[model samples]
Target: MTERACILDTAPDAVGGALPAPAAPAVSSPESAAPAAPRRDMPRERLRTAGASALSDVELLAILLGFGLPGHDVFEVARTLLAQFGSLRAMLDAPPEEFEALRGIGPAKAAMLQAVTELARRALAQALDDKPLVDSPGAVEDYLRLLIGGRPHEVFVCLFLDARHRLIRLEESSRGSLTRMAVYPREIVRRALTLNAASLIVAHNHPSGAVQPSASDRRLTRVLRETLALVEVQLIDHLVIGTRDTFSFARHGWS
Candidate 1:
């Protein structure tokens, strides 16, 4: 017999001829073999196409984080951070040790977050350099909020303005315990003299989230205003920064 005929004759199934064409190699369905879908809608892609403003706060944060940990996606990590801290501002304001303690955030990620907040603070400072405070009251309020709105303790900041009412310097003149801060008008007046500031805007945060000024707040404002006027410096406004809104003395006709 020919070679092929010999092989066919030798090979057999239980009751049949050759082994039924080897059962055609058991191919799997396409769905069973398909690879995972690609991640095409990442924050970077959306940011490039639609601009940074289009992204949600979490998305912006995910981009900053760059990548995820072994078991979590970057979005999940960012969401966890926000949920833990309660908001982006709170997260950014977190101390290095506290921030690093989060699940997927190590020293590097914590440093990155802190650096971002610092950059924002510096940018606001730069924006105020030659811009008149009266012309950009909104910017002043926003900068003040970013500076001390989330602090656990009370902080008093001063923005000293030149003759044209442009920002000359920003100083955190005092910081106190969670509920109280002692602000001295003599020291403030001396600092204004040292800077040769023609005008000033004073701000302090209310950790209690109340925008209404207390009696002590009003008294301090009056004292600072009178002390500053002694040296020809104008106290343009006294702003009380609360969690939700700012109380402006100028807006209320108190300045």
Candidate 2:
């Protein structure tokens, strides 16, 4: 089989180029006939011999990254992405086609990474949406995790409940920029009244991955509680979902 062309092979010829060449120090490379290790030996073999759980995150991701530049290896590519984005969650949540712009990363590899990341996301959403009434904190965690766990955007949702606390309506309350969201308490209560809801639960994502409520969050929730109290509908809880954790205002005695 023919070996694939690497970046060096695709560069303009040093001697045949139209422009004048600059001086550079000479370098030596290894012999061309040297034996090489198969890609299937590293990540794939580790997975095969040790099972998927036994592989480090870098090794597993290296399997997904597949290969790398001529002088670099797949683990280096995986490490590059990790270093660039800070975490696998950030890498998956980054804007579409953004990661492709990284060095040594091409469309094929980028597409593979995006597809696998999205596949897991879609599966999680499907699983959550198909489930029955979610009443417990665990269910809330599962549902919110699916929605906000790995996202790069800020999204707010309101789950309406009847007198029995059964879910009646699930609506998006707001979507916002990286650090701020626009919310109107009057509008939220008005929507709750329109839905004939007896109570409501609120959730929003912290793209910065800090689920702790900001002063703004507290002020908004206080206003929401007072407004909803006047109307007789209750504000049950306000949840902030971070990348790896979540914060519940109710747990902290906010609601």
Candidate 3:
């Protein structure tokens, strides 16, 4: 007999009757699987294609944060931050301790946020240094707001300008209690002379969020203007920065 016929004739239990039927594959439930979010809708991708300026404040923040905590998504974390602080500026200006207290913000994230604001401030300062202030009054106002608008105390700053009205230096001349500050016109004149500045723009902040200049503010402006004029240095403007607005003496004809 053929070898195949001899094996069929032997019906021994020892010989494994027949190979067990192939086992069925496991089936996973649809409810257990989550679809991945589309890449195009992600913040980083949107920023890359549409540009940073096109992104919302929360989106930019999400990029910085990189990821969210265990139960929150990155966008949700960013939204929580903004909602708690009220705005991006408030969040950035928040104290380190306070910032780190927020959910998903640790020392590293807080430091990153602080560094971004500082870089922006430095960039504005460098831009002022590169061009004449007269040509970029709006930039001057923005720089001043960023520097002092959020301070908790009064701060007097001076932007010393060269003959061409380019910024020579920016100085914080005085800091005082929350409600009051004293500025000296004579000392301002002395500094102008020392810096060989041909013009100056003076500014101060009101922690109370009032952009209106006080009687004392006007008096100081007049004194400084006359004092600088005696030495042929012009008083270009006096700006008062408040939380939500800024007062421009030039705009109001006070300078």
Candidate 4:
């Protein structure tokens, strides 16, 4: 599966049928107070009538972010964010620090955005953890993409699997510079033994968004595959994760 397939917006408007918008604040005349007026032509009202899918990215974002800072409305803030990031996917993939640095998005709003992104990752991880990965190669690719696709630096990850090929655990094995990572096969072997994992799928992200493996990447894969085999733990696959795609060694005949 692609990165787009993995990211899900879990907000009420995005998922289930739209919920009713809250009543507008009561208006007070000089003589008496009047009942709250009905909201109209607003994002929430539009979502209730049309549906979340009917709303634009800005509308959805505005709803997710309840209000905006002084001098900026929620829609304006949402538009600013989309303009800065260029797309909804890129906005969600952005680090919390990036969001915090933007105008109209303070610490609270940034945290909310960060939480949504993390929720998407955890939800995908839960699905992968519940079933055998071999039955769904697409899910594995989706999970890996969300895990490391947006990182500025390289991250080496390990998906430890049980004898039945179900995911046992996912671990960040190592981290390195934007272009280079030092991964140790012996350490991986040790971890597999410790976890009693019968098989493993390893992956690393390319900060440059290139899925092609380098000479060093190929050498490491060969050494790690051999080392894991000696311990009777299968090296199921090695995936090179890019921003939009993944390169699977197993799918490519383990070359």
Candidate 5:
């Protein structure tokens, strides 16, 4: 029998009906068969291989911002944020609304950015609570800056300290307009007495970004220092916080 006839005769014996055709084998192409290449230089990878300190500001922020909106990626979003704020410090000081206004940053992302500053402030606060201000002068200044440096209005804050100069509590003594604020010495003394604080450090912010103490600032410091002295609470320092710098009355021999 012919080969085609022989095959047909065998097929009929295997089943009552004709058999269905088999599917063609899948063809393998170089591009289709190869696995995706691993990314070595992404922010997460670099952060894992190297220390966090080794990452740039953009990379650090990109790690915090895990993902971005449809059109923008995390790296692009981080770059835009840094460019808009000009510095990491400025970004830390930004309000949540500012972050939310960005295209890729919604309420959740805004809260994350705002939390960064708060977390830093709380960490420094914990340090102060554990150690004396004398041992952590830089931490004290940093804490005050984070607390008030970016305020649009003037704010007077007091850090009540124990006999060892460890922080007992921090409170806002007064709040005012861009250029003026009312601070009551008696009220501060009363609060210190109530808290049984042994010493205190006071701070205020200049909305204009100037660290120089004004004539009023000097007078207030003098009065507050003398008033606290009467109540046996030593005034350790008075700090004037600006956006970029801090003026310490004690450091400048004004205390």
Candidate 6:
């Protein structure tokens, strides 16, 4: 007999608490068997035959996850991931551990997904490499969403840029609670100096997925700017990315 999932409605994507992993979805009895999946072409096959542009969201993700299980179907899993996290962009931004917490996600798949996600992020970062300047908050959001928006915890990352405002490094400064994380100003300056970065864009996530900066967040940006200025690194922006929304300090002129 297949083990029934006793787990409740605890979300696979939500942060801050642990929930039992649900058993893979299964039929109640052997009499009524689930039907065989239809013979739709695989995403990669279609990508090769038709093109990547022709594949749907589930197809793309199915290609990413590689294979589906007997109980939990690949398409269902992909949809669950999107529903749990919110969107394709957000799901791509989610951390490894968060992905691991899901029922069917194993270490290998987690590693694969994490590696691919970071690769995609760095690809986006590289796209910014040829740009000459940071002139708008929208540009900043495009950058942040590619890296930090859907993460489970509060990851304080600093995007260090060169004098021309081109990319230098995407550094994770701290990793923990969104409500409170220690980001040292002295260390920030030290790292910026060591990296020879000319400007900075700071970002953190709200696991609540609100993206609205709190009073403390505003205050933290001010401190980081002051410290960076002492060492001559300009503070360009602060971004907060959440599943449901995003907040930009540059747009509001926070610091």
Mark the regions of model 4 whose C-alpha exceeds 4 Å error after superposition: 1-56
Q: List the residue pairs that clash in candidate 4.
A: none
Worst 10 residues of 3 by lDDT: 4-13
RMSD of each: 27.4, 15.9, 29.6, 11.7, 29.0, 11.0
Candidate numbers sorted by TM-score from highest down = 1, 3, 5, 4, 2, 6
lDDT of 5 at 50: 86
Q: How close is candidate 6 to the true structure, as a TM-score?
A: 0.64
Tens-digit per-residue lDDT, 81-185, candidate 3: 887776677778788888766777778888888998899898988778869898998888888888898887888999999989988889998888776776767
Q: What stretches of model 5 exceed 4 Å from their correct place?
A: 1-40
- Which is the leading candidate under lDDT? 4
The digit string of per-residue lDDT tens for model 2 on 1-255 reads 543211111112111222222223233366532234664366688788889999766778887766576667666677677777776767776765787678767777777777886787666545544344344666767667656766666777888888877777789877776656677677788899898999988888776666666666777778778889999998888888777678888889994
Residue 107 lDDT in model 4? Answer: 91
CA shift of 39, model 1, Å: 4.9
Worst 10 residues of 1 by lDDT: 5-14
- Please give the TM-score that candidate 5 achieves against the real structure: 0.77
Clashes of 2: 0
lDDT for model 4 comes to 0.78
Cα TM-score per model: 0.79, 0.68, 0.78, 0.76, 0.77, 0.64
Candidate 1 clashes between residue pairs 3 or more apart in a chain or in different chains: none
Candidate 2 is scored at a TM of 0.68
RMSD of 6: 11.0
Alpha-carbon error at 191 in model 1, in Å? Answer: 2.1
Evaluate model 1: give its lDDT.
0.76
How many residue pairs collide in each prediction?
0, 0, 0, 0, 0, 0
Clashing pairs in 5: none
Writing each residue's lDDT as its tens digit, candidate 5 over 1-255 gives 322110001111121221222333245687765332232146677788888989888778877887666667676687788877767777888888788678898888888888888899899778787688877889888888888988878888998999988888999988887777777778889899999999999989877667777777777788888888887899989898876678899999984
Off by over 4 Å in 2: 1-40, 48-50, 68-72, 130-136, 142-146, 149-154, 161-170, 194-198, 229-234
Encode model 4's per-residue lDDT on 17-101: one tens digit a residue: 2223333333457567322233213778989899899987877898898777876667668878887876666788887778767
* Candidate 1 backbone overlaps, count: 0
Where is model 6 more than 4 Å wrong at Cα? 1-39, 42-56, 62-112, 133-140
